[model samples]
Target: MTNYGDLVGGDRVHASLYADESVFADELDRIFTRGWVFVGHDSEVAEAGQWVTRRIGREPVIMTRDRDGSVHVLANRCSHRGTALCWEHRGRATSFQCNYHAWTFGLDGSLRAVPYPAGFEKDRVSLGLDRPAQVDSYRGFVFANLDGSAGPLAAHLGRGGVDMIDRLCDLSPTGTIHLAPNWIGHQVHSNWKMWPESDNDGYHLNWVHASMVSSAPDTYYQETVLGGETGNQSLAVDWGDGHVELDFRPSYRRELAWLGVTRERVASYCDALVAARGAEAANRSLWDGPPHGLIFPNLFLGELNLAIIEPTSASTMVHWHTAVQLDGVDEAFNRRILRQSEAAMGPAAFIVPDDAATAERMQLAVDGVQPGWASAADPRGWIDMSRGLGRERTEPDGRKAALISDETTNRGFWRQYRTVMSR
Candidate 1:
């Protein structure tokens, strides 16, 4: 057994945690399988019989809307031969029928029919589809726990997680966000853990993304997180339960800074938002923008974009993301968002590829590293997250926060990771 306690410390973690296959397997079981993970959103399968396929800790699942308008997460495998039932990302289907054996299942995952029913002796109810024991959602964001032992999803989300989701959802004029079905996938040659860290880390923008800053000098990041330690008031905050954020609320010098446009450029969106939420709340939403945070193990609330971290192995993973479109926004406003997402998060976009390259390089440097090299006497095998240890402050709400360049966010992630992985 791995001594996760020793591997993960207050200000550092063993590099082996990123490269070890056994550790990755343990994460799949303890973190992804037993714990709650973001699967998809309710809007993806809004109508009855609509379903989308996803993976919960390597186990394929289908999020479907039943005839009664209830949502379910069913194992995407034929009950007979274990062949995959749905290969497509999404579709509308009254029932899922296996191509090989012709076994049919209802949208609710109940076994409906089997070819040559006379020869089938097993209980139909028992063989419908294996499903996660727990399924829940917050503001249409669906999540599931494969092994029901993880308890309610609310406990997993905590106040911080709930607040983050609410912050994003509240940005929409209708108090809801619509996620497009088209999710672009970027295969990265690094461990999946890199994303939750990279996406939330505020310290690397001046370095890893130096090119983006040099070229797009007036980007919003300049006011939010780009300057030196004392340059911006933006904070790197740790909202426990492994949720971390680079809070840019205080640093915005102007309203709509995040969108890189003024009230006139997006007048229709501004009007709709004001009409729906009133001036005060709408003004706050406009200034604050969407949350730039990570919801524990898998979800990345990337400002105007939503990203899903999919782990394929210890050394390989896929970063899947889509642009978040407001429900009541005009087509032009949404189109603007899509275009920004393409520039920021697309595979060949200005930003993500740089981070991907950094992660890949980090992976190569840490390859085959062992936990034994993490001791105090040897500094080589450890990744230090002690940047803000001395200056970090605790908020009245119990969140730990520090300067934009601090490692507060990194420590927050590792803190929760240690707690979960040790158990």
Candidate 2:
């Protein structure tokens, strides 16, 4: 262990945290594999024999529902030949057969049969598919872990963090959500860690997303991001366990309104939510927004979608963006939400590309500058996460809050990061 304390201190994180290959590998071993990471939404495999394949840490895994309605997380590789059992991202299937040797496994990942079973009389190999040590779901968000030693998923979700998922689900009239059929995925040459911190940093929104404001309708911009409007409506929240939320009032609808969604259209949308959860709760979930907060180690729930961050290397990551869909919403409402995802949250989305650029450029800076004697004070290896160090106030529920312009959430992420990595 390379003295993580040297790199991550009380008020600063070494930029090497993002640029070093060893540190990246350490993250995979100590944190990702050892902790629960989001796999797929429960609704994704809502049907019997349905499965969605995704990466958990560096290992490929599958979330499948069997005929008995039991959900199982399998390793996705064959027990016979070590080949991938399911290649398609998702599909409905009763069994997954190895493309190489015809070995097959049932929906629950139990070995159904084998080729020439008589020839294997003395064989002792476990023929069934490998499963993650533990798998669990909270509020329809499924997660899996490679290490059974890890604590339960809810324990990792931190205090009251599960409520965030529930609140997001409640945004739907049926009190549930499902990922749209097609997801928006983009690979970027940047460290995956960049996004966790980046997403938590609401302070950058006004500056980095100035273009977002300039491009929006003047009235909406004036009412929201312009001047003191942001401070009044926005809050910086540290939801602990590396879950940080940028909860703001009057955000989501403002974006739609800026893009020309009429008050009638917005009201109609809110009415469904109001009907589902009383006025106060609906207003909070739908209007007073917990805008696209990042739940650490690669699950991000935002204004419109669920994003999965998968790291390929020290400087490479791929993001999958799934549009949020209410199970029983009006078709037009679903279509409108999908359209918004296409327009603003997709790979080619206006805001996302900007975030990618910042991440890449920041990595370039770390790669571009060396800590020479002349630049020691401003070493390329260190990042100051000390902003708002002493300014944070804790809520009764243990959630930490700070000024919208402060880096309180960023530090909270580091604190958890250091704990996980050092452990």
Candidate 3:
């Protein structure tokens, strides 16, 4: 068994944790199964009979809206023969019929009918479908706990997580955000944890994404994260409970800086937000913009996009993402966001591929490292996360913050991983 306490330290982590199959299996059980994992959004199944297939750790599951407009997460396999019920990524189905056995299941996961029912001896109620103990959502973002032993969703998200989601949804004129139906998954030769770290890492932009900065020197990131210490006022915040953010609000030089355009470019979106939320809130949102943060385990609030970290193995994972479309914005404004998302994170995009390459390289470098090498004397297999550690300060609300080019976000994530795995 891996000693999580020894493997994860305040300022470093054992490299083996990233390349160990045993460690990955333990995480699937400890974190993904017993902890809260983001599944899908409510907007995907706005009406009855709509459903989407997803995975909670390694277990395939379905997210559905039943006849009465209730959301449910159930094992995607048929109760009769263990065959998958939904093959497509998403669809509208009043009932799911098994292809092999013809056993029908309701949207609520109830075993409704089976071919040749007279010979079926099992009680339908007892064999409906396996389900997670808990299913909950906040502002349309859904999450599930496979074993159902975790605490309330509110407790898990904490105030920091709540603020991240609130900041994104509040950008919409309706105070709601809609996720595009299409989700593009990017395959990476690295552990799932790399995403929650790299996605929110404030320290790597100047290095890993140098090409983007060199070509698009006028982009918003030039002001948000490119500047060195004292060059920008952006903060790397550790919002406890494993939630972290690269807050660019202070660094933004002008209103609508996050959009990489002036107010004139999105006049209709600005007008709609002003009319719905009033000038003060709308103006503040425009200046502050959406959050660049990670909500622990799986969710990535990637400003204009939302990504879910899907782990396939110790060295393989899928970064599934969808562009965020505001509910009441003009079609053109949403289109602009879509275009930006494609350029930044699409399959062949500039931003994430570089980070993916870096992560893959790191994986290969640490492929067979042993935890025993993470010793004070040798230090052969440890990744340091001590930047700005001594100077990071605690805010009034209890979160920690440092300069944008700091490792506070990485440390925050590893600390939470240690806590969860230790349990």
Candidate 4:
């Protein structure tokens, strides 16, 4: 295997990584299989027998809340004839029964019963359902690893990543995050990395989101809102071990007002948050801003909520967008947030579709062609996470010329990609 870290720099990436089938398979093994990938939040399986099915790497997985009120993630295939147990995406059931053979399994993934009790010998294990190697949760987010011996989920996330999630959840008053039911799922005809890298590329804000820029009041421009006006929003790149974070400053309360959230309502939300987090910390808890933060590999929590990028192949990816809301918030408030999110971040949103289109074009350019590379030459040399590499900071919000040439965040993404793939 080639050491991608040695080959990738701030400026260029070997094109083979995107186009090669072997490289994609290796990534599925090394990164996706071993890492603690995000499955879904605990709220998704709130009741006994409630379940949701998903795919991690090449393996099919089902996460269920058992009658015992514990969450379990297990392989979806029946151990007998290797048939999928749960066919639906989500539902409530006492036990998963294999249609091919009458093998039944409890919600906790325990082998419950088989139709033909007398057919199989007492010592025969072929009739039982097999559970995943390991299952764990942190902050209500569940993850499963096929390798039982894989290290702790916290250790995999590292201290910094865990703290970020803590902050994200803590922002809510009830200490729970609810997924926004309304969302858009689109399949991108490009590698998964394309989505995250696009988020990190701050320079595209003015150009790629030109529609938003042209229509949205200039008061909300990245420069006016986060850069020159308040300097509240800043970018941070933390790279250590195999994980990384491209943290951007959150959007300000005033910015939320532009989205139709009134100042009084924003204050009320803050007051509720402060009551939960204490008066001293209430202001910090309200991250009412434009932030599309990335937790290396596949997890992304943007301004709206959690957006998952699951790879189907090197040229194809499944994107799932989930909106998170507080527990007691009214349906109207949640719907408003969902509406704003769909308008700005969903698939049909003005900005994301354009990005998908660009990625599809790039895939077409490099398909089947060997010995190709994508140049990310920012003025700050290779691996530059700096806010304004070459352009002048016009406003305090760190607004540099938002141009297509800026690849600061892309560099941050590829750096982590190289680190994990190299390992």
State each model's CA lDDT, in order: 0.91, 0.75, 0.91, 0.65
Candidate 1 clash total? Answer: 0
Report the lDDT tens digits of candidate 4 across residue range 123-177: 4444455555667888887877666655788776665557667767776678767
Q: Write the per-residue lDDT of candidate 2 for residues 53-131, one digit (tens) a residue.
A: 8888788888989888878999988887699987888888889888897888888787877888888764434667788
What shift in Å separates residue 67 of candidate 4 from its native position after superposition?
1.7
lDDT of candidate model 2 versus the reference: 0.75
Pairs in clash, predicted candidate 2: 15-381, 292-302
For residues 1-423, could you state the per-residue lDDT of candidate 3 as single tens digits?
Answer: 777998999999899999988999999999999999999999999999989999999999999998888899999998877999999999999898999988898888988888788877877899988999999999999999999889999999999999999999999999998887699999999988999999998888889999999987878998888767779999999998999999999989899988889898889889999999999999999999999999988999999899999999999999999999999988888889999999899569989999999999999998999777776585788888999999899989898999988899999999999999999
| TM-score for each model | 0.98, 0.90, 0.98, 0.84
Q: Where is model 3 poorest over a 10-residue stretch in terms of lDDT?
A: 370-379
**Could you arrange the candidates by lDDT from highest to lowest?**
3, 1, 2, 4
Looking at model 1, residue 311 earns an lDDT score of 94
lDDT string for model 1 (1-423, tens) is 888998988998889999999999999999998799999989999899888898887899999998888999999998889999999998999899999988999988899998888987889999989999999999999999999988898999998899889989888899998886599999999999999999998989989999999997988998888778799999999999999999999999999999999999998888888999899999999999999999988999999899999999999999999988889888888888898899899679999999999999999988889767766575568878899899999999998999989999999999999999988
Candidate 1, position 248, lDDT: 97
